[model samples]
Target: MPRPLRSENLQGTLDLLVLKTLAARGALHGYAISTHIQQVSDDFLRVEEGSLYPALHRIEGLGWISSEWSTSSTNRRVKLYSLTAAGRRQLEIEQKRWDELTLAVKKVLECYG
Candidate 1:
């Protein structure tokens, strides 16, 4: 079984991934967003609805995303979310920060080992 997703484990990264997904994949419902992330990561990352819904609400509150009620392919009603201009900008900034942090970690690992 996959490990449960902890909010602390997500932290800053959730917003980044959420924003990037909206930017890249266009509008998606909460469940679709979670599934996209998990699929893209080859199932390495599993985002629970409990964690995802809060992040979606938080980012939407920030005006980073906008949503509207829409019918899914299955004819079920869902709130689809899309990235705003502000969200696109935020994604760029977050990607840069992530790159920097990973590069720093890579350097530390290389030097110490």
Candidate 2:
């Protein structure tokens, strides 16, 4: 059975997803980032602007990402976000941790089941 999606769970995974998305898709604006996440997750994940912007700021502060103002196709100014080298390195470490954590959880669940 698929696990239920919970807010707390989503919050924890959002950063990882964001980093992976930028790594794969290159630079993207906030809305594009949210849309990509939603689309890729088949609507399972929705990155609200309130949550998304703050997360972006936090990651940028962490040197995992950087942003610059750019004009969108519609000629509106938007901040385009891209992963930094540090961010790429962080993503690798986080990916390992995520894999280990999920494997442990799966083992625990299977053991109890």
Candidate 3:
């Protein structure tokens, strides 16, 4: 099996994943967002708290997302993050770029391997 993906390997795409996750799931806390990414990738990708929290704060400052403090189901306090209108628009742009990048990578692998 392939080695698990670390957050350092996802430097440029974390914001895209976070935005898409919020877009599809509505508001979610940092841990939930991290869980969603790991689960959906079938455990291939693991997002650590160190990287996730900073990305959350950075994305929020960009105005693409917003957050509020809320109580979780376990009665613990958490910061809930949701995508903004601007984020939805940015998601489209990010998706296109991702698609193009993957396609280029696929072409190279198909030719050389």
Give the top-scoring candidate (TM-score): 3
- Runs of candidate 3 exceeding 4 Å displacement: none
Best by lDDT, which number?
Answer: 3
Task: Encode model 3's per-residue lDDT on 45-90: one tens digit a residue.
Answer: 9999999999999999999999999998899998999999999999
Q: Model 3 — TM-score against the truth?
A: 0.96
lDDT of 2 by residue, 80-101 (tens): 9999999999999989989999
Model with the higher lDDT, candidate 2 or 3: 3
Better of 1 and 3 by TM-score: 3
- Candidate 1 — which residues are off by over 4 angstroms? 1-8
Tens digit per residue, CA lDDT, model 1, 12-113: 799998998898899999999999988897776778888999889999999999999999889999999999999988899999999999999999999988
Candidate 2 backbone overlaps, count? 0
- Runs of candidate 2 with Cα error greater than 4 angstroms are 1-9
Q: Give the C-alpha lDDT of model 3.
A: 0.94
- lDDT for model 2 comes to 0.89
Model 1: C-alpha RMSD to truth? 2.1
How many steric clashes between backbone atoms does each model show? 0, 0, 0
> What are the lDDT scores of the predictions, listed in order?
0.90, 0.89, 0.94
Models 1 onward score TM values of 0.91, 0.92, 0.96
